[model samples]
Target chain A: MSISLPKAFNEFDEARQKGFIDVKELKEKGKNIVGTYCVFTPWEIILAADAIPISLCAMSDEPIPEAEKHLPRNLCPLIKSSYGFAITDTCPYFYFSDLIVGETTCDGKKKMYEYMNDIKPVHVMQLPQTTIGDDSYNLWRNEMVVLKERIEKEFNVEITDENLKQAIKARNEERRMLKKFYELGTLCPPPITGLEILKVLYGATFKTDKNEQNQTIDNMIKSVMEEYNNGVRKVSEDAPRILITGCPTGGATEKVIQIIEENGGAVVCFENCTGVKGNDTLVNEDIDPIDALTDKYLNVACSCISPNDNRIELLDRLVDEYKVDGVVDIVLQACHTYNVETYRIKKFLNENKNIPYMSIETDYSKSDIGQLQTRISAFIEML
Target chain B: MSISLPKAFNEFDEARQKGFIDVKELKEKGKNIVGTYCVFTPWEIILAADAIPISLCAMSDEPIPEAEKHLPRNLCPLIKSSYGFAITDTCPYFYFSDLIVGETTCDGKKKMYEYMNDIKPVHVMQLPQTTIGDDSYNLWRNEMVVLKERIEKEFNVEITDENLKQAIKARNEERRMLKKFYELGTLCPPPITGLEILKVLYGATFKTDKNEQNQTIDNMIKSVMEEYNNGVRKVSEDAPRILITGCPTGGATEKVIQIIEENGGAVVCFENCTGVKGNDTLVNEDIDPIDALTDKYLNVACSCISPNDNRIELLDRLVDEYKVDGVVDIVLQACHTYNVETYRIKKFLNENKNIPYMSIETDYSKSDIGQLQTRISAFIEML
Candidate 1:
């Protein structure tokens, strides 16, 4: 489902740019394949299991008439869309479907694991819905090891420690490169727009070759920074300082940034699960690489899955570091993690710091543009 | 604690209004009330049997250091204020040495009940959080009856079936008056400002006497309807229609309405657990009155307890009746219920209807108004 739909929705620009490994061709490449679902963690290692490809379900337009037929309409849309895609054989390669991973951020997603397990082979992991401490991260690290083991056994493959270390190295290298891309944002003119950074980040995830992803990011970052250094697109210093964090705002990202800038605010800093949560941190290699990788992943764990994920702290830090006047927690429809975090962020800001924090959760659609503008205008005027 | 706290913080609106029920004068009043606790159901019959005053723990500005110590820093301020009033003994009427009552809602509130029961004598009733079907309604109805019997036995008072019916009538009448107030919103000019309605509705919950509440509401509703009929606040016809729902948006309600109007959108309808979830459908007198009342309460059950209690049909009905082009599901801080419901509402709107719905969660303060306004404006534009 992940393979075909990313193509159908044109979700992966990097993958297409790099070159294609068609599902049929990829299938011809190996057997005893294994599959798993993922959101935050890298798919590179899962593929390196020398098993089948592990796909990240980034949401695509596909029908799930069968899953939707039995499930209540109120269930999360991603689950519905995945089930819809699965049943239709959109990704016919998913037939083996060794395992499915799920998290518990909101009730709907919590139920998604339980609901899907009834229909097919499944593996469920309870992700932390709140950012607490190091507890959730450590727990998830242990669970990931177990999940990896289960995948190895299912595929009848030997997942050697050395191979696992290599996978960790590859993922860390990707993170470093992505961080370099984001660092360009610090430039006076921000050589790269937020969208440019987002595109390269998302592109890296779908592309299998780690070295190619690093090169693309390094090149883009260099090019953009050079342009900004040469006095290209200039960013005003007196613009309204804004902090952007939480889940995907979809296409609304540009609209949000535009609205903020128009209303005397500039999105100077952002902490989106997609944009920065997994970008800045690197896996430690000195210790047991597995535990080191786990520790690193835990330290920089993104997604709504981590219980210890304190979005308020992220916003607070951004506000302090960037001199942000306001913080906006933009959430996607059917994303439970951010919805739950929205309240905590608002409370912490209102009670402790008196910082203005606003939450906006929506489905990515072009129609909501005007409503979004008025709200932004009013919020800015009040500020 | 309730009595002592009100005295401490010195907010006497409750004490003065409950009619001179002073802690110092308790001995003179000749009531052997050792302690007091607030209740929703007829648990009072049980407290009375046990020779205790189940004081409806009305909102009080009392200081409760103990409660503040136990609760999370991010819990609802309103709830914290209530607890504060309890411990300070300024509202020293509550027989804290005897009992208290609590219902399940958000994780914070749920944990609050767990803490209260362990630290103090507490009577807990699992309140229905959602009203979806007749079976669930009947289940709550049965629970209410069992509760009444238990109360009678505990208090050692012969609460005859007749007394139970009267209590039921009192609550039903309270609801009916509240419904009448809500109906006034249907008028062309909406008899009163949205803020006025919210103030009155939340204010009335602390009042135990049915007659006084009904009288106040009846007058307010009448005046509002009269003003609407007299064409007091009608607006232009091109305004975009909006249906606002979910948990309370607090002060954001007015800002939302103002932004919508300014952006050529009209907030024609609103349905919130705090505002309308308690304004249940009319009771059927022909049926067992107590049973009927229970069902009614469960029918409009607030989505503050669990996501399992969602009424998508009710939401659909609102969209149809109100001619809504968009929806905004506001999730208040520490409110897990509305946060969960926000996801469901978003998914439902996306797949089933064309209406654009945006979810916003708040901590009930003055910040984030700009972000909310932006989201609202974009939503209206889409519509």
Candidate 2:
């Protein structure tokens, strides 16, 4: 059963054009809404607090004049995008209801939040920059506890263990299906089409309905298996397998995969927030769901969203699991946190794993496809 | 007339072996010492405080093992150096200082202050990352006032306006003479040699007696003028005039200047905390000296210290005053603050003026000669 993506909430472009769940309607229905920059780690719980529909306000849209009011022009594009949304009447349908939240992914984001909150009061917390280390993990956990209390104080909504558990259950189901999608990609010659995987993955996170998303993912998985069984997919036995690391993991990531494929390579696995995180699994279903969800989300930590911990292990696991022959660390300029950490990853891989690694730097205008193509060709040839 | 740099402190290698100031002696002498890293705008005033010595703890020394205990490996080197001195007996003089002051130069330095304050009590203040607007300048001014009070409270010393004026007078003389030396470098077939000027510049800063240092500078200037009048100097007329900008205008800066000169370019002027700032005239000598110092220092800010309101103007002035042909922005890899501001300077120069600019990123390693040479040669050829 191949389920179709719901027309209401599809791709980011479509959502941007069609407008997200209407703020006015939610206001009329007495549903409070809060806006955020990125879909953060503790997002499901934030959304589940009956605090209105939590929407991602990616700060990379057209420049907003109002953002320049609060932030310097050199600030990260994501910050500018958020400011643009905040000032513009574009999201009049989305309730600009309660408080906004900012997470520490990079210094730019962190500084932007500081400047933003100074202008307009927003509840802010510093997330762990890395996903590794018990101290870092606990710092985030403690922050979440404080954050939960702050949210409760602001919205006057009680977020009990039961409500959080329900949210985690939904998120975990989405994660499982997303994981299945990733496994399909790891299959020799990749049974599922990259296009189908992109749509299914995108829908898993952006879809308003959890059950429908799960259904869509299941159908996509079944169709991929059927296609594999029918032997209709193009299989490249000699193609070098690779894993793409860093941000811009949506359609931007596909470009990287396409480049690799064009250079006689195949992207077998992706460990990015926007890539396969929708398929992340639940951690210890028998345990407290909040902890489980935190663990699961933490385990699927996005390299682009925050500084990744143990990228060496992540890459090693991907290499072993997906039979990867090379790794491409695609980072962006102004995204210094990832850029610095990637060098360490490169050093580690070079010293320990004998893996061929190349780094690609992208800017807001990732329109330099020729440079990227040349780099990809060179990287593939080296591999 | 030339002041000989203490043989021990003549070169970085010798200084490393001779060791830094004795922090233990500083504590015993009852001299209120303020530990500072990089160059803060108000540090001159802090040093001017009665019986207080502002020990600039630029992170240019040996690998800071002690600082590495508390700070992450990738912290701003200056902060690490300060922390290293504070915890270790290596630089016992600066280590046992009465207080440590750190500013919000970058995220790492900001975090290091937090970490230090949390672990060991220290004074920390948020400084504006950029120096474009009045609010930013006023914030620094107010910070200077608060810092003044805080220093008084900690050291039990009255840091009067007179003392600050005296300090400024002495510092300005030092700066004026240094600028004069730089101006002489701009003379076609420069009258004074870079090595000789560097020795005197590095020596004059650490000299305890202010009047004697001025006398030495006067003598050096006279010698250079005499040499030029007689046409005895052999300076390169075809050399492109270069301006050095960055921190710790010491042996490393001198080395860079030598490299540029050897590569057929001349370091005609330097816009750095230690190089250009000592000459910033006291705005109101009759008024409150501390306030005058604050206003004056803030007026001519160094990118390595604080953001200045007139950075582009500063560049233009250097271009006009010293007749510089190019700007060489030298900053270390982890120097986030200087790196960002240098980029700003580069962009500003590119837009406002046709002066060629080159940015050199180093890790304070002496072995970076190859990288420095390549960039300098290319830049000189372009000029």
Cα TM-score per model: 0.50, 0.55
**What C-alpha RMSD does candidate 1 show over the true interface residues after superposing them?**
10.6
- In candidate 2, position A60 carries an lDDT of 46
The per-residue C-alpha lDDT of model 1 at residue A212 equals 63
Which tens-of-lDDT digit does each residue in A196-296 have in candidate 2? 45545544444455576577567766765776687866647677777777654543445666677777877777765556443444555577756665566
Which residue runs of candidate 1 sit more than 4 Å off their true CA positions? A1-24, A31-48, A51-55, A59-84, A87-98, A118-120, A128-141, A234-241, A251-268, A297-309, A320-325, A334-337, A347-356, A380-383, B1-383
| Worst 10 contiguous positions by lDDT, candidate 1 chain B | B1-10
Query: Against the true structure, what is every candidate's RMSD?
Result: 15.0, 11.5
**Number of the predicted model whose lDDT against the real structure is largest:** 2
Q: For candidate 2, what is the DockQ-based docking class?
A: incorrect
Q: Each prediction's interface RMSD?
A: 10.6, 9.6
Q: Grade the docking of candidate 1.
A: incorrect
**Candidate of highest TM-score:** 2
Model 1's alpha-carbon lDDT is 0.54
